[model samples]
Target: MTNVSPSGPASERSTGRRVIRILIAVLVVLALVVVCFLVWAKAVMQGERPAALEAWTDDRVSIESFDDSVVMTPIDAASDRGLVFIPGAKVDPYAYLAKLVDAVAETGTTVVITKPTLNLAFFDTRPLDTFTRHAPDVDEWFVGGHSLGGVKACMMAADEEVAGLVFFGSYCSNDVSDSDLAVLSISGSDDGLSTPDKIEGAAHLLPADATFVEIEGANHASFGDYGVQPGDGVATASDDEVRDEITDALVAFWGGSGE
Candidate 1:
């Protein structure tokens, strides 16, 4: 009875209050982080709608827009071969329509362009089937992307269903050297972000037979019709030229035609 002074109860109350304060502070910080991320994602480079409109209206390919993706199918015929293309981070999916139209029209290949989460491919955790399902007629599928999207595509290349891997201004982070999956790495010669040296350095990650193509005078943003990108080199190749080279490379990789 050495004058406890009823301090035990008071101390317990103070400890509980301190815990509540810490929890509230944590919640506030989390909320702020979420808010800032959303803001940053929203402030993305918009695609050229006028250029994209041409692809949407092209009679060679039928275009269908979905909540999570856009499907482009050849009107004349549908090939068993398909391509699932992902756009660069924060780049509009429509921006890539014009570039990929030739793949569908000329090759009769079904093309599915994914709309990544938060406008970034890294945030999207969906499986390969998520976009492929849009083209139920396609059996043989190739996975590809531009910039950051290509990096994500590399991750999906491990799926057994994927017939091949294609990279545009990007390279794989993981090792696929032991895998037999066919890989086509197409890079822009003038790319500032994903420089030729970087692609060459990561070449060992791909299979020994992986094909590498460098588009002359092309830059990081040449893969799509997106106006411009920060920290990207100046592109000397016209949009049409870049698209033509891409179509040629794809056709060659697929052995002349989609069949």
Candidate 2:
């Protein structure tokens, strides 16, 4: 018989090497994709310092920035009620200070604005205590957010310590219609991102008694002081107008008393 030169073993070795090389190449490509995604996610919309400065200087409310959250408390008489507010996707936590300052001052409700992981709320998987822990004094806690952040808040509304839910130009994807949690859905009439129709469509997801408010001429970006967003509607309502409406709604929702 003619010698085959052990060709079978050689062929098997060559095939195995090719497979290894292919797997290495795939892994390298996957790694690069992950890196690019993280880089893009980290690039976030910065909050306007001038507007944020207003909140910092306000004597009525005290603002404190921590590694994971920004806490705003009323200087005179703080309320037992507190809110854990999450920022919209890619928005800086400070962007909300200006809009929320009035609420903190008027309601005396401690506001904790969270710095979500990867600058996006959906990526943050921590429990409610992760933020509420900052305000050990707060007895009743409400969770809220803007846009995508509101969706994340809805997910956490079921927590035992959570007393309510608030949305700013956002709606819940998960059903909490049966839950007795007090829910507030605030939407912008001129919002191009979370359009009026979208909010109305998702209305059934909230509790039957959920309160809804529409800020006329307000756009998606009006909810924060982060300048104009790329796909947002033109805001006919001035910043002051939006702020007043939001503050009023919040006060009314909490039974017109922060205490």
Residue ranges of candidate 2 with Cα displaced over 4 Å: 1-6, 255-259
Choose the strongest candidate by lDDT. 2
lDDT of each: 0.89, 0.91
Query: What digit string (tens of lDDT, one per residue) describes model 2 on residues 1-259?
Result: 8776556888899989999999999999999999999999988898999999999999999888898999998887688999999999999999999999988888879999999999989889988888888899999999999999999999888654688899999999989999989998888999999999999999999999999999999999999999999899999999989999999999888744445
Q: List the residue pairs that clash in candidate 2.
A: none
Model 2 lDDT, full chain set: 0.91
Off by over 4 Å in 1: 1-6, 256-259
Best by TM-score: 2
**Range of the 10 consecutive residues with the lowest summed lDDT in candidate 1:** 250-259
